[model samples]
Target: MRTTPTAHPNTELLVYGIREIVDVANKIKGLDPALELTWENIGDPVAKGWSVPQFLKEILTEEIHRADNRSFAYTHSRGNIETRKWAVTYAKQFCPSSTLDYEDILFTNGLGSGIAMLYQMVAPGKRILQPSPTYPTHASFESFCSGNAPIFYKLDPEKGWAPDIADIEAQLQNHPDIVGITVINPNNPTGTIYSQETLEAITRLAEKYNVMIISDEIYFRMVFPGHTHVHMAELAHARVPLIVLRGLSKDIPWPGGRCGWLEFHNTDLDPAFKDYCEAVKKRVLLEVCASTLPQMVIPTVYNHPQFNAWNQQYSTELQTVADSIADTLNQIPELTVNKTLGAFYLMPRFKQGSLNNRQTLPITNPQVKAYIEQAVATPNLADDKRFTYYILANTGIVCVPASDFFSPYPGFRLTTLSRNPEERKKTYERFAEATKAYLGSG
Candidate 1:
């Protein structure tokens, strides 16, 4: 007799929405080789034509050619001590009140790996209150660990995508199992840089509820003009246990480098928290260490005279693209467009009742249209996802549905990372035109 293959229960909880859409688009591309897919589904700056700064590249190259180079060997399990020390010193400029030391930093392959490890170490039966419309990795891993759909608090789009504090409090009150709260400042999918007041309010709740705060500050340095990035460590002030996640991927435009670290704050305040940190470190010991090349060049790249200028220019360009895209999308009366103040994404939501199952864009290829029709026919398909599929088939503009962010709203998230002004304008115009046609159809 033959036996069926078995899989772990946790496997079912893992759903990466961005990749899911990308897989569909990949199949469609195979079906139509001529389709020019304009990728807006993911937040890869380099994929959209941005280049890494020359100074940083030079620093890495020099490190690789050095006589004493240890780039090929593993460092300490917690990452290079000198690099961690540099991180501690540099981080202080933003969070003067933080009590983090070199020992508090633990480097991981990337923030994606770091996120998975953090949630995996959570005690069984415990949960984390994640934001709706969250970065999929956070929600997926949190759910995988707990064996349940993630508990969520809303980020109200009507209020500039700010966290609903009262809703957060209510969820904490209602769900005693929620052990931590995750915040993505200059948030993904909806580029909203949280205000200081907002961060403080969240810190207060964490203090009151006695839950640790997981702050994803990967885009900390990417704030556009007229906004400042507020470090969560400053708000916690050694009163609340905090885990601050940072990375070199976005700001450095080095996604391939895959370097990120976790900063633990106020672990001394709780014995259990201290033990938890130790457990995480031990887990890191199993993996040995993160990439050595990126670790060795941290101090040089950050302190380089040209670094600030490069980052400023990058942020300014993103702001221009953001404003232009927002303007174009807003012209469609059926959509609600919020001009992003930080980061490089624009999430345009359809006005309530504007999207219906019956609406779709015209796809010229009959085979592609048939495939999409079959794709959307799945039971309980989200309105935003259906529209996203239609957009992919019709205009070859691939975007992630906002619903994949575990959002309750109907919309889609697209990046403003493309450096070409003319191409960006043309893409958004075509998208806007498709939006109008889709909404008007039903």
Candidate 2:
């Protein structure tokens, strides 16, 4: 039975539409089971062959054996004391300038939750500036809470997706209501790690603008050998306040663990910002605590030497995978590929004029082709999303549309985390074929 809606949704809160993309793919799957579907749309390392390390699994299993009634008890709403302590030590080791105390940290189910709670703390009429092609979770929440489209400083794709300090300055100069700035290190879709120079420049901009910084360093520890991951907390001078968000989702490849934490840095430097952090904690307090078992896993892992070695090994493997995917995608002349340095994803943009409303792929599967033709014909659909649907129905490969990230461009973001190396290569190679065919540029 269906009921008519009595209340209207805040339409402003509807920008994160990746799930619709997934739904479209599933529909295509039913139309053609012969095609193998490769879901590269989102960042889920565990699904891509980056598995829980055997050593960590062993540790988790042993902990389960020792579990008691106390293990199931609710932890502190902010975080378990021991896990927050470990986070303090971890933050200090990497972020040299990070002088985080236990009280400075608060844990959430994952970085997504952390971002939500933080955004809810922002006052109405105030804004948080983010990067275009941002991780949708960050962009959407900030926008949804403020009931406005996200305001962003550009990450110019031409200059290898680096932040244009001049543009950032202009945004701050023009928008007095923007009270905070976001930095996604070793960024999500683009995979461009901000150099130390860029990090320092941004921190200075925040200080000059009197805006706090929100640095999502979820991929901090995953940068390649030559690229350095700077924790904004480390480089954010004491004058500028920041909230550093991190988690084991990428580092430990434990997305299901849903464990992430926030380190409120230099909060004392701005009493108003300190109040905001307290308010976020108060809201989280109602939920009691984040998932507890994952918190327990961390302290135990820290004691094992294999854990450290495992991280380094996993990072090196990702570097190899990222390079391979970039190399493959760049081979297609119609696409502009950026080699990701830190995270396990890369974005490829269609060269200007390569994709337009008139475009159609040579999808021989009649049902698939018909579905796509109907999809692209719909009014107001993003061209990139239409392209993504064609890619899905034609090639059984799914990549997120760039517009989903609030970008002012047409492209798609794909991951290098396919479980099998050979299959991963084949997936992109097939995509290359499908792309070349779709654009008629081969």
Candidate 3:
């Protein structure tokens, strides 16, 4: 039947940046499954051969039996009240000045859900201000909710991927409609840690502009030595309204838990923010509350005495990995790798004028070369993404284009999550070789 297609105005088929690029890469793929492929694209630590300690695994096992049928039952819409109280006590350890209580905490499926809830609260035509080179999930959610793309302030790559205070001030001063600012400490894709001074400046800006602060501190405890993660709630001090989102996925060393929560700060200082908090809780009820079993494990998992010990040990080793990658990639001459100070990712930026539109990586296989040629024929993909596709085909190395973080930075993010020391060194060496060869081709 040659009937006209029906219109669906209210529907959306949404895709975030990472998956979207990976899809394009897959569509143009020409390689066979002849070799093991390395995934440097996704940020799952456990997937890369990192394992939780035996003691932690036992905690889970014991909790399941001890929790009884309650663990299997649905929790309150705001999550198990007892768990909420425990999370507040835990979060308060970092921000002792915080007055947040059980009522101020709300659980979500993950930090991602918490983000979606917050974005949905943005009034029509109003939006949140995000840092450039942001994690795509947050960026896409803000875009989806506002019906308009959010504006990004600069995170200066020249300055160790630090937030540009002047740029932030200019953005706030220029755009009065920006209701809040979002920051990811131990920033993804770049792994740059924000200094206490930098954080304070941001806090002062939020307070001065009378805007809310939305912080994603998912990597709070993943910091290396000489650097510490500060809770925005610590600096905020109830002066400026704030909401800090964190999760068990990273620190609990458990990604599949699907457990994360938000802590509201200084909401009573602003009537609108207070209302927003109430709205977020009601919104979670719409989802019938995040999965219950993971909520059951939080109090037990966090309060364990040795939790901080192993975590610090892990952090120290992670610092070693970061330094190794920075030193290796920095030696490439064609690359400038940022020394990762917190998270387990490293962003090696291409030196100025290192890549051009017509540049490409070598593809010995004619079919693969043709596939990439076709994929990059138009000005559709970012230059770094084109490099990603070529690198995938040529070396079986998968990585995300760093500029995809939306900072105009020419690079890609690689992780230090590889558990084997020998394999980690070889991987970075191969990466360096590929990058140098790729840049040399231009």
> Considering every candidate listed, which one attains the maximal TM-score?
1
lDDT tens digits by residue: candidate 2, 165-242: 999999999999999999988898788998888989999999898999998888877878777776677788587888
In candidate 1, how many Å is residue 287 off? 1.3
Report the lDDT of model 2 for residue 10. 50
lDDT of 3 by residue, 172-221 (tens): 98899888999999898789988888889999999899899999998888
At residue 384, candidate 1 shows an lDDT of 93
Model 1: runs farther than 4 Å from truth? 1-5
lDDT of each: 0.90, 0.83, 0.81
lDDT of 3: 0.81
List residue ranges in candidate 3 displaced over 4 A. 1-15, 21-30
Of 1 and 3, which scores higher on lDDT? 1
Models ranked on TM-score = 1, 2, 3
Predicted structure 3: clash tally:
0
List of clashing residue pairs for candidate 3: none
> Residue 409 in model 2: shift from native, Å?
2.7
